[model samples]
Target: MLSMPLRLRPGDDLRGAIEAVLREHGAAFVLQGIGSLSVARLRFAGRPQPDVLAGDLEILTLAGSVSPDGAHLHMAVADAAGRVSGGHVAPGCIVRTTAELLVALLPGHVFAREHDSGTGYPELSIRPVPQASAS
Candidate 1:
């Protein structure tokens, strides 16, 4: 695993930015993230639509896995009044100040999303990288 740091500026879409990193690294996991956001789009448990929180929000926690197919991230944030809310991180999480993350890249494996009949949603599929012969 290769660990690297990522920083995002204002107006960056949190999920998209992380997905871009995943695309570059092939497979990676976000160990953690901290930052401020002007807007937060989060989908609560069992909700089809995401709630948009717009204001000075502080990211309390962020962690997830990122594959070339997509990202599955969970995040918690605190509002100006100290109200905390957490849910699945969605797109349009625009940065207010900055977003700093530590990502671990997997070099010997690949991650893909495959539809699972049991869950009725696309799920992560992990596979090992094929070793090449030196002959």
Candidate 2:
């Protein structure tokens, strides 16, 4: 596994920035670490409007996987009031100072998202990446 560290600057959409990295590498990666966000736009499962959280919010937990197809990230953040809220990471989550991230890449596998008839959601479909020919 290769570890990648990223620092997202202000005005960057959280999810979009990360997904850019995944596409840049042209592979799948596992996102792991604790980060901070000045503003959070989280979409709760089944909720119409996203919970727009602002201020110095501590990202308590962040976990997800990014594939060539898309990203599936879940995060929990605590506000200044100590109230914690989280949901599927969405766009418009602008960063404040910065957002630190750690991602791990697995060389052997490729990940893709496909529509699942049962869950009615796009789910990850993991496959073995073909080995490249020797130079």
Candidate 3:
């Protein structure tokens, strides 16, 4: 497992940025943990959940995982009010302020996405990625 530290800029969508990184790096498995900061435009499933969170609050925790293709992402975030909300992240969620993140990359595996009829969303299936041979 390889780990990298990330600092999210202001007005950026935390989840979106992570997904972008996964796509760029071709990460088969990604583990994002230990985030603290503020963000806005929070949503759960398909609906907005801002009412459940206080205004411009500090993110006590922000954690999630992503696939190489960025098909599935699960995340949870807490505010200064101590209220936590999370789910299958939706699009358009933006950062109110800033966030710090730790991203782990797995190179030996490849993540493939397929739609699950039961869950109604794309799910990841792990596959082995062949190592590069010395030229």
Residue pairs with backbone atoms closer than 3 Å in model 3 (clashes) = 37-59, 39-96
**Candidate 1 C-alpha lDDT tens digits along 6-122:** 999998999998998678667889999999999999999999999999999999999999889999999999999999999999999999999999999999989988999999999
What ranges in model 2 sit over 4 Å off?
A: 132-135
Sort the predicted structures by lDDT, highest score first: 1, 2, 3
Note the Cα lDDT for every prediction shown. Answer: 0.94, 0.80, 0.61
Q: Which candidate comes out best when scored by lDDT?
A: 1
- Between prediction 1 and prediction 3, which has the larger TM-score? 1
Cα RMSDs, all models: 0.7, 2.1, 3.6
Better of 1 and 3 by lDDT: 1
Q: Give the C-alpha miss distance for residue 59 in model 2, angstroms.
A: 1.4
Over the stretch 62-124, how does candidate 3's per-residue lDDT look in tens digits? Answer: 555567567454556666666777665555556665667777777777776778899786777
Q: Relative to the unseen true structure, what is the C-alpha lDDT of residue 53 in candidate 2, on a scale of 0 to 100? A: 87
Top model by TM-score, which number? 1
State every prediction's TM-score relative to the real structure: 0.97, 0.86, 0.71
